[model samples]
Target chain A: MRKIAISDGDIQVSTRQLPPEGPEPKPITPAAKDWMLFLGFAATVLTMPIWLQPLGAAYPDLLQKFAIFGIFAIGFNILFGLTGYLSFGHAAFLGVGSYAAVWSFKLFTMNVLPAMLLGVLVAGLFALLIGFISLRRAGIYFSILTLAFAQMSYNLAYSVLTPITNGETGLQLRGNDPRYIDRAFGVESVGLPQTNLFGIDMSGYPGFYFCAAVLIVMFLIAMRIFRSPYGLKLRAIKSNQNRMAYTGFNTRPYLLGAFVISGMYAGIAGALLAVTDPLAGAERMQWTASGEVVLMTILGGAGTLIGPFLGATIIKYFENIFSALNEAELASAFSFLPPPLQEFAVTIVNPFVGEGWHLTLGVIFMVIVIFLPGGLVEGFRRIGRLFRGRSGKRTASQAEVQPAE
Target chain B: MDAILLQVLNGLDKGGAYALIALGLTLVFGTLGVVNFAHGALFMLGAFCAVALNEALTWEIVTVDPTRTTAWGTPLEVRQPYLEAQFGDFGAFLVDFSVPLAILVAIPFMLLVGVIMERGLVRFFYKRPHAEQILVTFGLAIVLQEIIKSVFGANPIPQGAPDMVAGSADIGAWFGMAGSIIYPWWRIVYFLFSVLIIGIVFAFLNFTTYGMVVRAGMQDRETVGFLGINIQRRFTIVFGIAAVVAGLAGVMYTPILPPDYHLGMDFLVLSFVVVVVGGMGSLSGAVLAGFLLGILQSFASMTEVKAILPGIDQIIIYLVAVIVLLVRPRGLMGRTGIMET
Candidate 1:
């Protein structure tokens, strides 16, 4: 029997292929598979507001973060998971994107379209510059190179580029500053302008929907990339770059393309962050910020299509909900327990949540890395396999008994 | 000329800390093949050791004196540290020397912490990929930093040198420049201490049988194991030694930069840059690069240089590292193909 290897996102499965004399392998339609995935993704994202309420994550600000960071993690997964190249400096792009978006806001209009477009374009260009230098080296050296570049950018943003970045106070909207689009269009002054698309305000539910739609589009693009021939080359590069090199495949362009694309995605996410929050800070570009996205991607499942989204959702939930859980919330959560027990529980658990949320995150990430290297998605796959294997064995036994009869 | 000398001295002092930390990092990486991200955390822990010792040495006892009631009629409280109450002048002298004396506390604490970290968490990650090792260690670092933060609120706690070495020394007079150049006494001491430690480490590695085994294990782990030598234990001890070195560096550094929970992370990336630029697993290379980059950084921070290219000092090390790594992939002194994979 010949081995037929297939990959569905990050998960690879090998099946036995029968000889030509046997019945032909059942034909599978690629378009049908793509359509099914698209439909499922659309339904889940379109109904995020309705579904997320149960998880106490229906708020606009958080919902927007969920979508934005999902985009970021997905982008990161493309480079790291696909090519096996970990870039610690992706936050540089994310920060650059935010800076670009904020600049676009300062120069043009409050429209998020221009901001996002500019953010993505600028970030892509920056990524190209960094990726060119960084891609020259591989392994830990590559990681270090990217890190150094990102750090240089961060340090510059923090100190040197104070005029452009506005230093530590961050770039914020001003009443006196000339917004050219507002001038040309003769838009009247308001208290503080909100980011909008055409006329719809990007706040509350509207903002979440806008972010979700963008997330869906980004997810679709990621899915398309994962299925394309270029995607195959990326996977090949990850599996064996030396062999690919020997086979006359110039890997640099593919690597650079993936890096730029991922960087652009990060830029868009950064733009969305600014669109939702309306402020861009230098701290957004810090190494710790970059580390957080790495944590998200890894904790979710690196190679899987849905893993980044899941990871982003979980991490964002911790950042938003888990961090906000105070004594009162903890008391309410443990109300079912006796009063003394509840108090003890709150006291015990208090250190791992709220301001100590990072500690909890660190512990959880360590546990995940140690116990579940495949991440949360891998756990789901293990459960599925266990059940499927049991049922398949039962069916085979039943078929054997029928043949005996 | 004096300004240049001062800057050079400043660079050496900074480079000393970098070299010491990078030295330990290289030892751990070379011996265990695990990139101990928690290495910086060990340095922070070492500084905290000094802080802890200071707190312990200055443990105060308060007693209410009923005979001395004042103002609102509350009894006057007389406070005396137990050390002072017992030993008086000697206790005061001890408290003055607490920063230097904390080296005693740091060595054992760092060794213990290092051993536990290796046996407990890092042991599992040895056979794993570098990525996994990095992630696990990074997680441990976060956990460690957070624990420190929780214990001691996220603030820089200043630790001072003894009175004798508290202020700047007139080094210019010694050099015949006559007060044109003065340098901090503590900084000079720190530089000498680092040099001494570096010397001791090199001597230990070069002159000892254990060091020979370790060197052999670093070159070929399986072959050393085949020789029936317990290289694993030696490496674990090496890990402890590295931690102690890092800790000692941190302990001394508290006077320069106050001890903080995030101090580890602040230095970690820079230390890693130093290590890579020195060339991974290259001991003498780490030292050379550390001093080179350190001096360059100090020089870059000069008023003239900053005037020409603002904020150059903040990122000069990283910029140098990028250039060095791109131009010479094996680093300045790294043996080729060590960690190329």
Candidate 2:
């Protein structure tokens, strides 16, 4: 029933971590890197909302929401992309962070910074617990185990932890609960220097600027991690886990560490959301939510630095914006058309838009998987390669192959 | 004593559903090696089949005769013989006989769904990693559920048994019993019906020519193909059979628990854990694990146990799965050659 391996082949498919003794790859010059990053960021600052604001039909709302989700997906990609271990329970960590942040607002404070930190810390702990048990298995079995854990967390949150999570009623601010850190009524909170943190009055540009600052800081840290030696080790483990184990390296610690760190990143995003909304619910922890991020990462282009942002934006914006196009809205929009044409437009576009957004998403996802396979990022590179021919071929390869392998 | 007996009876009925769904899943996984994340959706489709049949059976007047009313003043006509005969006395009861009639009609549609799903979506993922297969099927299941929700709003549609089976059937006196058991008669009928269907499936797989081919194919698809047997056709038929089993389970399941858009998701996660703990591709193993897990869960929910622990019921099944995975990775009855860890 089996054949013995007489020799190793040219494919060199080693299931182990690469040797640590191998020459440590030279670091990118900080000056060149900072220059590259700053130039790109500067370009984005100039082009955003102002240039995107007048896209007429689409709205800057679309771009703004996408950026938020992109952050979520990017954090997730750090765990799944680098480690090659898919976590079905990652959403639990995010939900835990959200609940923590919201609870902070509910009990101690409305200050965004504290709420965000607490959310991240709580999510990190949850990830630690789950990863400790589940990381015992590998491949598909490991994924299923994590899945079971997530479902368990979801059920417990919805039903048993109803008092804490407020169950299906969802926790909302009715201006009743005593929030300790929230109100100065005059001075700005830590989140924004202009308004009170909780009941604080940091209402105007100050609050927006605070959130933007946090996003920029998070982006910088992520970029640093992406280029660091630690990141290279993570990729080595991802490619050949068993080989690493046999090479006298305890791969578990590295893998688990990456998982917890990524989970903390998700927590930060969750905290930001909760502090912004000041509410948390068990629905945030649903299995569907986990699936949503997976869709975002793959759809945007997994592993690429910028891919997660693009993916997250598409999904989140679609979620918020698409839901706005209700049947009444669709019907009303076609009102100026000819009677026959108006009725036809309503019937044809109705199912694929608005309440039918999930249908559109599922269709797009399937098409990408089958045709483009590498996702939106790949699709862009392909166009660029066509004109440059010999010169652009390598540029195209760098983008596509780097993200994939 | 009565409470204990009632709980045991309840457990058996619940276990019947668990066993049937797990059995079909095991059948698919064992031969086709698919985890079948959409199996629960198939079960939901089966329940909706009953709903479809119920809609189709709206009574119409045929040969209306004044004499048919007698004292009730309701115009009687020759309705479908099944509903007319079953609900002669208690026509006003919540149990719509149309749902029961739909069970038979739904089988063909369920089989078609099974075939179409496998050919259209599942076939492409056969060579892919298990995660990819799970992801794609999971997507399909969500789409299916949402489509159903959009079409029929997310509410638990109440479908009951026929009038005669609406309330408890007193088997009290037969076993030297003292009081009424209070078990719904339809549940009793459903339990017996499931056993019969399980028997038929077993016989079809164990004693027939098709069964022989499928069994051989399960062992080695390539060898079966090499031997001039059409493994693809056999797999299709096996899939059809698997779907029918799940559908029957769903149809009979209607009265016990009303069907809802989210009902499938609620059942699917646990059933998957069941299949895994039972061992992939082990039908008998799934049946054994299903009943055991069901009974254990009921015991976990008991007040006696809750006296010590507050939320024992929710974690019991998952805890057991973790323990089982640690102790016996291949499951108690797992075949040596099939998905051995």
Candidate 3:
């Protein structure tokens, strides 16, 4: 009984003779998008080692860093991208996690499982304490408070806490470090203890696979959270906390919740770092390191499920691969070009690689922030739209509305 | 008592540098509402300007001396500054005073840099989020630092004060306490210079018609615009002035702390803390808090304090900041409802 009419160059529906509603509009299953995104992310993670070999980033160390920092960025996105609380102190938790892991190794067995669990638990507790104080203020004040706390932590860790943090040398396992679990189990002392999970060595290919598996699990958890009702509430806080408040939502608890979760994620990342290298340094908690995570989250397209990981991978690639491009490597890279052209290219590109990699990163940061505020995710979306627009007979309006799904 | 006096003097001198940087930071924040993470870089550029001027004044003309040879049988190269060759004693004096002379160069350069940065980048970010402003400026700071690093390398380049002021002044002797309370002559000069510059900035802001308009714009930009004033243009000029102030501070500070790529970052965090403690957008508060924190830091660094607290000096400023934030929230002189959200 409904009539669809074209009026004023727009389609209008007249429902005067129709019923009010039609079977609840089929509920618009949100999990479909989440599941699709998760699968895509999983595929990428599983195949990165194989695919990235051509890009000269296939080393175990680089891959491990990618996975570890991916977790850091993902956790950071939860608090920053989703909730809009820009913390300058997440590194404090990361440092704490590392210290906790190393201390676990010193006191107990070299089993990474217990060490990682301790790291997460300690970091979560630390976050709760910090979040309690910092969440009292919102916006810039919140950022400043977090910064102050972090600075205090850094200063203490570098000096007053030297006995525990080992002053600038960082926390490392000594030969005489008490391994209570190993001693009780009647295991003899080796030259140097390495992190192992159920007798599987946490280094090289196996180590990467272990980290990759953990990353997938973490990613799945993040995906679930993104789809959950609580994540929607966090987004609501980001969009407009005042309105959310008027609707009887206590935003502070939710914000605190996000902060703690993110902090724990950083903790896990820190623990994994220790598992890979078995050392924890005070420099890990510096503000610059904190800033690095922010850059990664933003660069990868914060708020998206896979964007943080992508950002982490890209930044790590730059740090590891691009920074390693010596003059010889550059000359080899452009060897196919004519002699003059090759020299010219090397001259032009020389300042932005090797020791000048930071300059390249800075330029990229500025350009991305200025041009692509949504980061690489927005770039991908635009490319997707362009291809779809060319391949299909869809109208511009239809293409615009497609993202609403 | 003399030790206490000496510590007080040290605090006041340190406070002077902190106040100048924080004053500029507060001025920009008050007018433009942008948290300039690159302001420290501007200060670093100023220090480098002094370095550049020194290098320029000391440019050498080397010639092989036919009359002399080294133990290795190489010709002894006699080097004379090109300036000295041209202007004799005047060139030597100029080289000695290069740091002070560089103020002239730094002022115009910093102003231009500030204006270009504002117009080219910050102008677009006016309506954007503060986070974007921070991020963009942070990126700029990194680029600026890296550029300087490539040019200057990673080491701190030392700059010395003129020979006449290199030694400690017996200022206490004037008051019959010379033996106990001596301080560096250059530090006193630096302090006086800071006060003079601060006075000029205050006078400029308080007494002039331009200052009146700027102050009004700071209060209510739309109202000032409605009155037919170009507030945005004025704010750009203020940003330039802020940059100049920071640059001049850097110029003067070269003797106290050597110019380095990371110097700006080290000062920036502390200056931000000063601004917050002074209360955001309150120039007077920034000045007062700068001195207060500076003195407090000096006292915390005392051997006795160290004996008791054991490295409290390193964290005293941050600790005070945290406490101040918790207790006051608006800072020492922060206005109501600004940046509270």
Candidate 4:
């Protein structure tokens, strides 16, 4: 949650008439728009390596993390950003999916395809059971119950299902777990033997590409949904639940559908994580972890399609890269400084930079909440409007901020 | 039977904790119309106060009196502390039976904490949306935890029971729990103390004029305001009262779990769940649900549910919450008033 700076306001707005029913939302802008979005995505992807190259050589594994969490946030935004219904229990689905994927890989085969499918299926099932009951209530009650269930799942994984989840050590295979189909690992190509594309050796860069391709496909699918009828129904639900109910639409199915879809997306993200790491732990479903996704969604721009992805990247960047600075690293970076000055920098920052990364994260979250209440995307929009407003152009925010009396 | 009885006592002790935290949560929610996620942190602060007070009382020197040589007709020395000078004499005495005495000190200190917290952080939230309220309080909780961790370090302080209440009681000679339900004296004392606190809080709320006015304000804030009453000030006081309840709960809980910074995070989850089960803003409902869930948790982990599901004990409370929500969305004792309005 972003910190919101508040003060007593003297101004209050009263509307003489309710908003008129607008025409159906423009379904699809055009194919040209789609091409432009694709071009922008391609440009971003291509330019990532310029900044990533230096750190990628040192810790290549961390680069993949930002992408994975970005996918998770994107999936989360589909429901929370669009529907106006916050689900704090979404991480439970992620946990279930991770475990399910890992188990499937162990029991059935290490083929990434089957494991990912199993993860999605299992998470969807869990979501169905929880959603059936949780969706009965709306608003904050809904979020509270979801949070409780996530905690319960985490506790269960940590305590009761010790044999299955293996408690704190978490379910991991040193080598004993069976992997019948994957004779190799992941998706690579012809007889690589250690990596596999559908049983080709794929524990290399190719697998990374495979995941990226899947992300792009998912993104496209999400964009399509945003323009679809189901999406409109969700928007309607967000606008006014009673209006939809009186209009004779069974809102339950829509709510359930949105939930299950979001759960499946989280499942896929978790399954991907499991495939990459081959272990799943209960920590993924903790309340703090759920809160992280909420922060990511808000920080990036919840309602917008691309906001969560950007938010995820920022958080992950801070988590993996920003925290990588150590005393030696700081000293080396500031070698040009005077000896005493360099020493002071190292001593002052050594405690908080590396292991105290969470402290930094907490500070960042607080700052984001207090300042960018709507999030970073909103910040960008505000910036754009400021430039436009100065140039004597009309801006939507200006209209809202200074409504005509 | 012995194990079961002992577990039942354990359940009640835990229930006492839940009740303490829930009572605070209910008061805040009822009066301020905000869900405070940081209630657990306040409880932790109360327990930490015990540790802080205990550390302050140090008797550096003891003087000997040689004139009291009676029993053996020889010179005998009696020592007395000359320096109960600094922090306070009460704090010096508190170091001896720290946990119990801490409870006494924690009430007023916690009241101060309550008033300050309401005035500083929570007052601004009285008008915010529930999500914003949750966010601000959650941030405050994190900030509070960091400050405590910064000052006290992260390790759990080994607070001890008083000498008079040091060991487990011999129940076998007394009653139904004779061979079964022997509890540590300190735990039993804490539980009894909590019952007394709960009674006092209930009495204060029900039998007092201020309590009546507060309840009336909770029922209809606008109406109370229209009658020319200072509803905001009363709401702030209720917030203070809520803080006291949470702090006292923490104060007594010190000997059981020992005070640690992260203790609040562990307890807050279950306490909030208890609050939800009790059906938001209902005092009696919070207490009822706290004890009910505590006992059910104990029973579930007993050989009963384990035989069927193996880990039913871990998720039973949440599973039950789901069932309750499905059957009665308003919860077991939810009010007809609109929540999240």
Candidate 5:
């Protein structure tokens, strides 16, 4: 055998030379990869009506919810996923956005553009005020502070601010309301003016496309933020805030910026809700609504770019599809079995569907939090790794072992 | 003077309920380091225990009596409660006092629930982040309330106080007041019951050796564990005790607020505010903050106050919570670095 020269005890020196440098290789750069991701996301969202048809979720109302809540969850992820600040008052902003949009429809014009702008502006201001007070404390304190402010707003909206909010009846488009823009333009309608994008009514497929476009744009912005230096600073804040502070980094402005942006996103979603439905209810500001956004973020994988969107889609799908499954439908579905067995199956499955959809949601949420803390995205990654064969396994094991050294 | 006194009384009654719930919350937070979002569910379960017991006691045996005919020419039905038939007066007494009697059943049932939850779920989450703990417990809360909703339906079930204490009491006479200061008799009973439970818990924690070890564990689990103590077991028992306290509070509160499936959620948010305002891990602080917020809430609801500040009562508890959190970052009696991270 040839004599082997050992360097540093553990290293065996080999007489191998590195490969020679070649001409600059054409590679898929990070920018190109991001562009691919954006295209893929846009394709998925734009074609949802086609793909989601098989799942019975292609209707305008449910599709609109998917887009609206997708935007909400994406915005929430920027704050909760990156900064690790769990604000339980985000629904207040959503409610504010809806109210602003409705008021815009009543006073300005039936066009969605001005309504959305006003909604976002009002929501941003509200977020600035709440975030200023709540960001003073960290951890659970911050969550409670946000929750308190939201509850206060909810209560005020329900009672004291009835004149502005329209109270329990919720703010709705009135036939006689002075639409100055529409009036000045000499555009008069016989019935309640439908919320529109110029001349296109925002109640059907066209509306879905509009919301889809906004969702795609929001997703692109979120993706940009994820890959940007600001996102890296946010991730740093999440990992270790004190260390960042020690490094002379002022994290407050960054946090406030993320918060206001997320609030504006929620506002846009609220405006979209009014664009489709033209109503704003105090119930939208309830803590449960806030919790729903939180659940969507966590269920989709908070830190991941597309996780919240996926989560919102899954939840809204469940809300619409599962809840619509009545006893009669379930009974017929199980009619192929023997009478006794069929009855047993229906009884067993009854509480998890129909009016009991929330139970299933709770169970799924618990299971996800317990087993897959990284949410469905993490589950998908695990499954993908398993299918990638021995080479993938070897790399994963190597990655795991490298940490020890 | 009477109005102020009445408001104060109203505050005390509400405070009793708040203190009871917040006390258990603080205990669990202190010993287990778990933020149980399902504590409110435990209280709701306790109230349902009363409903269940009442339903059981009043379960009627219906028989068609051929001797008597109905208007439609069918045999008349005679219904007698199984308990009343078996135990006579005692069974009737049981039905009448089922709300109070629920305390007996709820104690053991809630203890088992608390222990099961600790061993099966919460213990595994002890090492997780507070956010995860809150999320998991919140999911559990939803699961519990949903199950209750399925069983009880979506409406509030009315539970009655015993006939002996159902009427309003002349408390003004006892206080030597001018105007008749009337209050519900059951409310007085609930207030007393809460004080008794609070006293018992305090005495148990402050007087017993087991309590001493648990308190030690709360302060420094590692040190206590290093001393050859099974701090984990003690913490589990502490959790059971906390559940018992919350359950009893619920059991007694049914007559005041009918036990609905959503009752727990309504209280859950406010109780959290109470806990945070009292401080994260301080028992006395929790109790103090509970009463303080309760009193403030009742006073805010006064017509005079509402006239000055519209919707003050609706948001007073949360307002106090926000103010307290901002002014005293650690809360009234919160120790430094408990849940600061």
Candidate 6:
């Protein structure tokens, strides 16, 4: 039997091609396979509210967060996963998107469509400016440059740009405002305005479905980008930028394009956040916020198409569900054991749950980075291989191509 | 002139902190070729070392005194610190000097933490990609900070300077200036202490045989390994020294800025800017860049500068970093082919 190797960036899976094992099987086209994957993903996401109920993440707010952060991670993955350029400031784009969307609500209308568009546009422009300067340097220099720009934006937003960002109180929808489009359309404001799509209120279940739809669309675009020739150039750059340059490929535009597109995705996610809750805060632009996206992208699997979304879901699940778990819940959960043993178990697990969920996240992230650099997808792949059996040679060959210093 | 001098002094005080933190960062980057995102956590740990020492020193001994009964007729409970009760005036002196004396505990403790970190976690990443190193270290940083949070309860634990140096001193009189320029005495002490630590680190690296081996390893690890030298051990030691420096800086900085769980993350970003401006893996560059940015920040915070450009101080360091990065990508003191990819 011969091995047929299927490669996705650094990850490779090999299956044995058995000689006429059965009646000649019809070949499945790559497009068909992609469609199947997309359908599976869509089904999983659409049914998250049902399947995630057991995990206590079925609520509207948490579902919306899952969708929003999933888009953020996917966008981040486009830049970082494809180009191997770790931008430590993508949260700036998210923040810009949020601010722009909120401003759109204040000045123009509360239509989610216009707000998302404006957010994407403004964030794209901001990314273009920052990326233009930052992409001049690569490696850690690039990371630092992006970090500085984000921090500068954050500082200015927090303190100096109060006229625009409303400083510490954050920009919020007010009862009195121009809302010119709403005024022009003769839509009377009776109370604080809620973001809507053609008069369909964007809150609770409807808001989640809206965000989920956008997330699905964004995922499709990301998948298309991943499979395109343009993606090939990005992967080439990631592998060896110097070689790509020597071969006369002006990589700046491609990198800038990826950066801007990803920025727009983050912007859309941010706009969705504002749409769901009509407020924008400068803290969204903080370095920690940027770091969260990075953590999500890396924890899922950087180069894989669906990895980031999965990572986002896991993290948001932990943030919302695990954090909500209190001592009473823990004791009840461990009540099967004797009283003293249950108490001991609770004490041991106490620091890793509730407000300490971040501690669990940190530990898990470290473990993944150390053992499974490709993130959860890699973990799944290894488990699959283990069950398949007699795949030692394939695994060994895979290890040879793994990136090392 | 007095105002300028005071700003300069304030700049120096802030610069001292930046320089100290960035120095350790640069040292680790140079020696191990590892970007330690947890360096700030080390500084925080150092500060907490002081807090822990103070807590241990002041373990209160409670006694019921029936003679001091309250209006409700319950006996009054009197509390005295165990150390003070035991050693009297000497114990009080020790308690007062706990912040400074934390250096004694922080050095060995931080060294152990550093060595354990290097041996346990960092060494494994030596052959991995820089991105992985960053992610792992960043995760480690979060874990460290979270652990600190769980222990300390998210509040800023105030650490006081000794009574002798708690008040402001008139430095303008000493300088023979017409106007009085009063500066906090603890800040001055912090500045001097940072200078001493920086000097010691520089001297150690430049003068010692072990440091020479570590420096040689930084230049080319493979070549040093071939030269029958155990450079890895020395690199681990260098990591330990770096931790010590950062820890001591944190220990001294508590009086100026109270120690909190998230303090490390706050300093991490700024110090990173310092390291980048100083040039990656350049020791002297880190120091020079640290002071330059700190002084510029101090000047930018001045009312005159603020009037000219609102909130320039908040972003001056980053602005300088951007300008320096754009104009000279190698940074102020960077060498060729080190992390240039």
Tens digit per residue, CA lDDT, model 3, A1-405: 001111212211121123577753333234555677778888888788899989988989999999999999999998998888889889999999999999999999889999999999999999999999899888777887888888889999999999999989999988888889978987656678788897888999888888888899899888777767788788889878999999999999999999999999999999999999999999999988888898898899978878899999999998887788899999999999999999999998888899998888888889888988788987887787688875432444543443333
Candidate 6 — which residues are off by over 4 angstroms?
A1-24, A391-405
- Chain A TM-scores of each predicted structure, in the order given, are 0.89, 0.79, 0.88, 0.81, 0.92, 0.91
lDDT (CA) per prediction: 0.89, 0.71, 0.87, 0.75, 0.90, 0.90
Recovered fraction of real interface contacts per model: 0.71, 0.24, 0.68, 0.37, 0.78, 0.87
Write candidate 4's Cα lDDT for A1-405 as tens digits: 211112112221121222569753333334546667866865664356465676553233554566667778888888887777888888899999999987876666766788889989999999888888778888778888888889888988998777888889887754555565544544222421232345453444555665666677677777776767787788778878999999999999998988888898889888878877778899988888887888788888887777888898788877775578777898898788899998987776655566556556666666676667678888887787677775423335334554222
On DockQ, who's better, 5 or 6?
A: 6
Error of 1 at A247 (Å): 0.9
- Per-candidate clashes come to 0, 14, 0, 16, 0, 0
Against the true structure, what is each candidate's TM-score? 0.94, 0.84, 0.93, 0.85, 0.95, 0.95
Fraction of the native A-B contacts that model 6 recovers: 0.87
TM-score for chain A, prediction 1: 0.89
What's the residue-level lDDT of B215 in candidate 4?
92
lDDT of 1 by residue, B89-194 (tens): 9999999999999999999999999999999999999898788888888999999999999888889999889999999998999989888888899999999999
lDDT of 5 by residue, B142-217 (tens): 8999999999999999999999999998888888973479999998898889889999998888999988898899
Per residue, candidate 1 scores C-alpha lDDT tens digits across A1-405 of 001123332221122234659765554445566778788987897788889889888888888889999999999999988898989899999999999998888888989999999999999999999999999988877887888988999999989899999989998887765779977898756677888998899999899999999999999999888878888789889878999999999999999999999999999999999999878998999988888888999999888888899999999998887788887999999999999999999998988888888899899889988999888887887676578897655544543454223
Q: Write down the worst ten-residue block by lDDT for model 2 chain A.
A: A1-10
Off by over 4 Å in 3: A1-28, A336-341, A390-405
Q: Taking the candidates in order, what DockQ does each have?
A: 0.76, 0.36, 0.72, 0.32, 0.79, 0.82
Q: Is candidate 2 or candidate 3 better by DockQ?
A: 3
- For candidate 6, the docking band is high
Docking class of 4: acceptable
Interface RMSD of each: 1.1, 2.1, 1.3, 2.4, 1.1, 1.0
Residue B269 in candidate 4 has what lDDT?
76
- Please tell me which model should have the higher TM-score, number 2 or number 6: 6
The number of clashing residue pairs in model 3 is 0
